[model samples]
Target: MKAGREKARGAWQLSLPLMLMITAASVGPGVARADAQDLPIPCANFEITYAAKPGEVIAPTDIETNKDSFWVFENSGGNLACGGTGPFTCAGLTVTVPEKDVVHPSTAKTTINGTAAALGEQDQFSLTSIDANDVTQTCKGTYLFHVSSNGGGWGDPHLTTVDGLHYDFQSAGEFTALRDDRLEIQTRQTAVPTAKIPITNEHTGIKHCVAVYTALATRVGSSRVTLQPNPNVEESRKGMELRVNGKLVTLTDSGITLKASSGEQGASIGPAAVGGIDGHIKKAADGAIEIVDARGTQVVVTPQFWNGPNVWYLNLKVYQTSATQGTMGIVPEGSWIPALPDGSSLGPKPESIDERYEQLYEKFADAWRVTDATSLFDYASGTNTATFTLDEWPYNSPESCDVPGQTPVQPTTEAVAQAACAAVQDPKEKADCVFDVMITGHEGFGKSYQIMQAFKPIGTGTWYSPEARPTKPPTHQGGWVELLKKWWWLILLLIVGLLLLLRKKK
Candidate 1:
């Protein structure tokens, strides 16, 4: 970019006339007429920057007049182009030039000192720019300019000013009196704006609005359930209980109780219950809940927003712990989807109500249940060489699936397996539960071990079948016994009477 300064043949033709007019109107003793020599190049300054996303903006600041002279520079990367749209525009000092060479003059109407300024019909203004993001290209585009003039002020670029550069810049890089002096300006290309990530909740029937704050406390869905600010009685009062899967939970001042599971409210279960964590439990003072596993690991939950009634944002976290360490991770919230009351659903089928849990169970159950080296590798969220073997079957049967891991303190395998199976109605679901029960024994083992077992590995010497086959018939079937026959003579007489009546009728 060069300084907008150069003498033209018509410099005097344009300036001389202006100078004569100024002198004729002037009564000063020794004031000289304006001339190229009288007024040196206007020193100016420029600023530039870029924002690469929609709703993002970049504008130059600290603008100085001709005192600071230079073009604001910006680098446009390959495949990138830069220009202002909407409220954004290229603005600077205004300069006047002949209507014939004014470079894409804008026909925008405006009032100067309460008088409408008429735009000339001649195509005087011109603007150009090179494109370099793609294949070989140079400045080859032109755009119209929003032109305006004041007694001696900035020439406001109207909203209509599009892409490309405006040349007719005054000595001060602004719109001012132009006296036939040629000006050349150039602008480097820059990146265009793109879209941004949206924030939303994924667990429940609540909508959360994201805002900037000094600090944000959040949890991943993999962490244990944590409630903030012990559910304020008032706030919690308005809160309806919902199953983790969004089943309608009946609410009471005591706490949200699972409606489907009577008396199993958050308040009903002991702190040790795994699935029934007190979601509304809060910190003593901070109003945050920190659910820690036996390994002293904290659970972090993600908020699942409910789009139904647009209630409060709900977050959930699950924690897995070992003797030495525990870990937590975020559960991603799905795109905004409608949520219905517990047991009910938003989709066409009621079965879709537990869609997430069902989907996740299917996706992870196989990996979680396989306890061999290969199974571990298949589902391992991390790398560990540990292997697992069941001594006497830690998990109760599927029916009592909620029973915790056996450590001289839990129920039998049959009980837990029964519980798990009871939770589902489908044969496939029961099979999955049975499978889960078997894998629980092999849990830390690598998948290779599982493959070695022919994928039919047995646990605790107990044979758990997806379908229970009856071994023998019931010997104690205690219903009503049959009676012996005793009415032979009466039956014979009834038959004889029936025959005689048929013969008489014939």
Candidate 2:
């Protein structure tokens, strides 16, 4: 009896720990681990000093230094420079010239540290000077300089004098090494006491001008750099051209505007004029340009450019929540008619559809592609009474759905269904037709099914599927499999309790 009691005690002790572990696992806090790539890389800060030519010194009052002004750069493999060697090349140094200053208006410069570093063809750098009258003059040149390991020393000078003002700029800064292939250098004016530079505007004939200037630099390729005026301080004007992916896009005071390749006015997207409405454009994950308007309308434009004899056209797909309210019709290449303020057309009447059945079928197919049941139903007639089966249909082969280089299989069954609808003789009967469509190849499965649906014409060019307009609640299929799936946990608990009871009896 003593030995049996000891054995039972041991079994209970082991089961307690196991049960505790299971309980803990089921009820413990859930913490999600983030991907290493998603974590931000840490960065270090450093100070920088600048030396200006004797007469080109800035004022001390305008100079402000803080944590925000510190240069930020990423380190590559724990090295200060990208390649982890001596003499790294920094490119694309953009300088912003302050307004109300008679001295330096704006300047851009590039610096090379190593002798082997070469500038690429795309690198652009320049310096501009504005006189008392606001007249502007620019000089283009390259500046080469170096700093010691301790961040002290003035290197060679690239000097330029414009309108009796001697302009010379030199820089020295401490480099902070980072984990990624990047480094940050912070530099302040050493010789100059302040940040404000006094200048005269030659264009406006204004004197005693104190202008503000800001500078930033970005590395390009291995050695080449292109510099420009600071965009934060300068306001984007009506005619500013922004180069995006080798194409020149215009920026206006209102918003960004895109022009067609044929020089025609394209789409102008900006903040919505209506209250409680907003509109914006963004790049999609698939590399398509998507524009969303205030009314919840979306227009997706493909990156593929269609170059014609005169202009370039982009493939566009427009979507709206309401089919009747926001319907888009395809217009011919050059048949755009300007509408007057009083609702009068200024050009030829709208083109008439010769193949009405084909047009209706296309609309139906489009609605099906997007899984818009309401829109699909709106294309049928009111009197036609039939049930329509709404289910997922594979429009492409599994191998070619997302794979490159393979053409996707089209939904030929939809075409076959449309052709059957078009074969009706009487116009009235054709407008109100019934179709039994059988579709196969769903998600690469060869399963085929049929759906009996009736369509009726609501208006001259409008049709709707009557199956969607049900007067009563639809019936649903239910069985033991579904009930077991929902209550599986209860059955599992019962089995566990039974096993524990049997073990205790033993």
Candidate 3:
């Protein structure tokens, strides 16, 4: 019985060590595996370069104003042809008026100094036809105007007629006050021309025929004038009014219409006149007046004035389709169009891609340093796995362990990675660049490996990751090898015990 007991004890000791070794090799350490929480989150502190499309304007293109006065001219249908014939043509007329001082609160008149010239190919008529001789002449003159308030109304009555060598004209007008320091004027006038020629008859040796020609020299519609306050002049708000005639008119960006009003009219002049007696009024950038006619002809009126308190002097330049005339009127200049509020400028500018990549890499590094799982996932690819690899096992070195109160050293060099990403032009490709991070310092015994986290672009210089990290504990060092190394003495004991039992049996 004693011999049998000794043999059994030796057999049990040999098998026990082998059993423990097999068990240790099959099962791993108790610690949990490194999860996404252990991974480094990519930062987004990067800049991005963007390109603008062609003709992309960042500022406004039109002029805008809140207040101003305008001298608008509406055309009245009148045939001013010299002689009624086929292909009717009229001589172009230009007038220049010198500035005059206004005499207020009195019966005294202000005299206008100016000259008038008749132009175009139709002004050469100097012939004698039996009873009458026709002569073409240029007339120059001055206008005397007086302002009186007689309680009933205010009138700018003419003190003297516009009398020249061959023409005599008189006008009566009233000024109506409007809101915001504005005034409207309506005027009516009549002109007559007299020509004397020598006639020889059969009965009389020599005779004179006096021909008095009558024409309607009247302004049919009203004109508006606003007081433009000059910043340089104290309490100086002075302007003039204008009246022009046309059949149909429209206002366009390029120019105005003076014959038949057509095209797009941005704003309305007044009630539309039937049978093509309409006109358009537009304000230019320099406070000039643009008038268009039905035939697409334009007349630009620019005003010049001395803005003095109580009294003002005004001069005007009227530019026709091809000709320009200097006269007397008021022009409101310096109005601009409103612009949209975008940061873009009028032209294109350059942006840097390398700088943007550097910023992005820095952001990623920051997130990784904190081990922020959420931020890491957000900046990584949604479809690909966020992989992690370790050069050495966990707890192999003090720096590799996740100990309390210890910051982990980042494994990857951010500058090198960022440089690589900067070469990629495509946004998606840049975002998908591999995030190879190495974990340096961890306290726990859990093993960690190198990481390759996938990322995708989420637009507007952002990236996202979607894969979950592993949660199971890593196998301790070497699977079966480690187990055998730890329990090799047990195997030797088993071999010795088996040899002793065999010897006893022999």
The Cα error of candidate 2 at residue 242, in Å, is 20
Each model's TM-score, in the order given? 0.16, 0.17, 0.16
Where is model 3 more than 4 Å wrong at Cα? 1-277, 295-297, 304-312, 321-506
Candidate 1 residue lDDT tens string, 91-113: 22121211111222221111101
- Candidate 1 displacement at residue 423 in angstroms: 36
How many clashes show up per model?
Answer: 88, 53, 56
lDDT of 3 by residue, 103-200 (tens): 22111111111121221112111111110111211211111111111000000111110110111111111111100011111111111111212222
Q: Model 3, 359: alpha-carbon shift in Å? A: 84
- Superposed Cα deviation of residue 345, candidate 2 (Å): 1.3
At residue 185, give the lDDT of candidate 2. 14
Q: How does residue 488 of candidate 3 score in lDDT? A: 67
Write the residue-wise lDDT of candidate 2 on 209-229 in tens digits: 110111111111111111111
- Which regions of candidate 2 fall more than 4 Å away from where they truly are? 1-286, 289-299, 303-315, 319-343, 348-478, 499-506
Candidate 3 backbone clash number: 56
**Deviation (Å) of 473 in candidate 2:** 14
| Local distance difference test values of all predictions, in order | 0.21, 0.23, 0.23
